[model samples]
Target: MYHRDRSPCSALAVSRSVERPRAAVLLLHGGHEYGTSAPGAWNLPAARMVPFERAVRRATKEHDVLIGRVRYRCRGWNGGRADAAHDAERALHELARVAGDVPTVLVGHSMGARAALRAAGGAHVRGVVGLAPWCPPEDSVRHLDGRHVVLLHGDRDRVTDPKASADFLARARAAGADASFVEMRGSGHAMLRRSAAWHELTTSAVTGLLGLTPLSSPFTGEGRLLSGA
Candidate 1:
């Protein structure tokens, strides 16, 4: 069953399955407002999370998927990746408290990616997935050691630049993380639903990262190594 609630901090959207429960995917929205609940108020610039939601639902046909569209300060001095990560960590803990101890996968876009990485620090998170995540702080590299990370970026993305995500992924791999990169050719930063390219790539990456074999996107071999910025 999927549930939506308004918390003192931010609004919550969760979907869980009673049958075929595996792990959980925690979706975090990109930077926008601090803590406001209004329609389309927190729509991130380059991070299209709507289709990601649908993709997760389809992929988790046999598992539970939870999405948390948080509203934290993402503007002004207090509104940055660091603050986003701090608040996101709190929100994940709250969700975990309600859902019990289940394996978690963190999915973030843009600034949320930084937050997800920070939250994964010392937590029981299974993996971290960043979609067009910006350059993280140098100190943040230590937190990703021995963690599973999947970084996705569009080759035509101009907002965050594909090379930025590639560089982060490279550093993540160097830090001993099981990190991989996927380049979506011809796709822009704003992911269009029903987009064959976007759908295929996301479906493959999400499923593969979660240890599922997708018949639609069969694996032949690892893709190309995206060069650093």
Candidate 2:
């Protein structure tokens, strides 16, 4: 129930698009490498995000929304000038054009999660959902100010530091943004375990961010806060 669309003038790859939607969800996948120009295909992130994309679409089916999965042109981000971020910027612009100022939330993993946070300052973006994000200390934490950001990081994740996410949330709150960090237990970067928990957490966060539903309580665990009133 998704359409495969490619960016004619740019390297933005839309895995699929929805029709007559009420809202939009832009998905950013993880992983990037240098020598992207030497690639034979758009091998960045491969199809690792397909399952998540479908999960988003399925989760939001009742909400009547569009889910856009982006395959970036530049597959690298290390000392790479946020190439994926630039692609996400264009992808958001195109999404706004297609969806017309709809309430939008960015959902991304790792590298894509950082891009989502970077590009979330756009006019139509209302919130972001980052899954096991890989954020450097240099990544601007101010761009996420005043936007709803829900970070789902696995406590067992060895790929991205969960502590970084916690630190980012503290910074976001200090900047007066409505943010939350759900420290997922017993799950890794892939989030293969506790499937129901992941889906529910994601759906609830998306709906609550868009004001379609009441926000979940921040009273979750020790030494952590959801950073909202």
Model 1 scores a C-alpha lDDT of: 0.62
Clashes of each: 3, 0
The number of the candidate with the highest TM-score is: 2
**Per-prediction TM-score:** 0.77, 0.84
Error of 2 at 179 (Å): 1.0
Error of 2 at 22 (Å): 2.5
Best-fitting candidate, scored by lDDT: 2
Model 2, clash count?
0
Q: Against the unseen true structure, what C-alpha lDDT does each candidate score?
A: 0.62, 0.74
How does model 1 score by TM-score?
A: 0.77
Kindly report which residue stretches of model 1 are placed more than 4 angstroms away from their true locations once superposed.
Answer: 1-3, 10-12, 15-21, 32-47, 73-81, 137-139, 212-229
lDDT by residue (tens digit), candidate 2, 44-93:
46455666676666666677677776657656664657777887998888
RMSD of each: 4.3, 3.8
In candidate 1 the C-alpha lDDT for residue 148 amounts to: 74
Candidate 1 lDDT over residue span 27-60, tens digit each? 7667643543333554554246777767777866
